[model samples]
Target: MELSPTERTRLRRLREQGRSDRAALFAVLGAGFVCHLGVVLDGAPMVVPTVYGFDDDFLYFHGSVASRSLAGGQTVCVTVTHVDGLVLARSVFEHGVNYRSAMVYGLPRALDGDDKLAGLRVLSEHAAPGQWDYARRPSRKELAATSIFALSLDEASVKIAEGPPGDGDGPDAALGLWAGVVPIESVRRPPEPDPALPGDITAPAHITALAT
Candidate 1:
């Protein structure tokens, strides 16, 4: 259950954390929307940011067939992160972040036909749970124009940080500084529609539900 060296080094508190925890990894992946995918292109490493979806055993990404980042024949390193808050300690040196992040390393397989369609649907729904079903599905030509890739969830790791900073009760404790966590969260706002649409038109139930 050892985390890969590359992934493990990304965290500052490696000694204080364990990266092989599956529950921690899944939590990070479940809370994120965008993932940065790294692949080799022309012998150079290329990191592409895209929306992704993941299950227990696989990670899915979709794009146009013309996307070289996905269609390239190389392994990929994908990372998803959710920053929950900023922990401000009495001393700047002890300032830290409350976050959950996951990194997965694997080769991607281009899905064809039915699998491709299903993968796209999964990704879309993942980004917006009810939006996919409430919106129009892809047409035949649309499906043909798209490409979906799936990565096995074999090699991966998760790192997490929570609660207050380390300086809360350190030498800086008597510094008389106001220190605490500035909690951060992502919230979905109400959807705005085009002005040209009918004045009587209202938002879909799914769109209205986004306020939650």
Candidate 2:
């Protein structure tokens, strides 16, 4: 399935970076666990950083029941981005960052009961794979205190910028300046056990494997 472009989603500038394929959207979303959720609160724009997870159809996020940002039934824009590298060009104007980004727009629905629990599980597993089953599940009271929301993935857009600088053939190239891509990557370090945890308790295989 291809992404349907709405007026807000259509890329007017740098159209070459825009991606209409659904797989591109999934790739951008799957590469990152954090997302910025944009909404209108009290007629003012608000953007909140939060952890999110997604399956085939919906993106899920959770917050305290009292959190004004998570109050659903209204349209929201969720964005995930991954910076791949820095494009150092001969000229400052040509310098840019290589990145993959996805923006999802939809009206989020508040989840409840089994659906809510499933969403929480997806969220947990997305952040830490296999830990959802390894750790204690949320109790009924805890579940009641949390609010989970699901936003449809039907409306979304993806953009990816990569490769070297784009000014190799420009007049600036004759200026005798170096231009190349400085690669960037996110690395996972060894797990640090909680100070309060007993020394005898070691990090589980699932958690330790991430550092490798």
Each candidate: RMSD:
3.1, 1.6
Question: What tens digits encode model 1's per-residue C-alpha lDDT throughout 1-212?
Answer: 44445553455556565466666677787776688887777777777788888777788986443257657667778888888899988877888899877878887999989888878877887777787787899899988877788887777877777888788667888888899999999988888898998989998887777674
**How high is the lDDT of residue 129 in model 2?**
97
Q: Model 1: residues >4 Å from true position, as ranges?
A: 1-15, 19-21, 63-66
Cα deviation at 35, candidate 2, in Å, is 0.3
| Pairs in clash, predicted candidate 2 | none
Q: Give the distance in Å from residue 66's predicted Cα in candidate 1 to where it truly belongs.
A: 8.5
Off by over 4 Å in 2: 65-72
Lowest-sum lDDT 10-residue window in model 2: 63-72
lDDT value, residue 67 of candidate 2: 55
The sequence of per-residue lDDT tens digits that candidate 2 reaches over residues 16-107 is: 99999998888888777889888877778888888889998999987453257557357889889899999999999999999999999998
lDDT of each: 0.77, 0.88
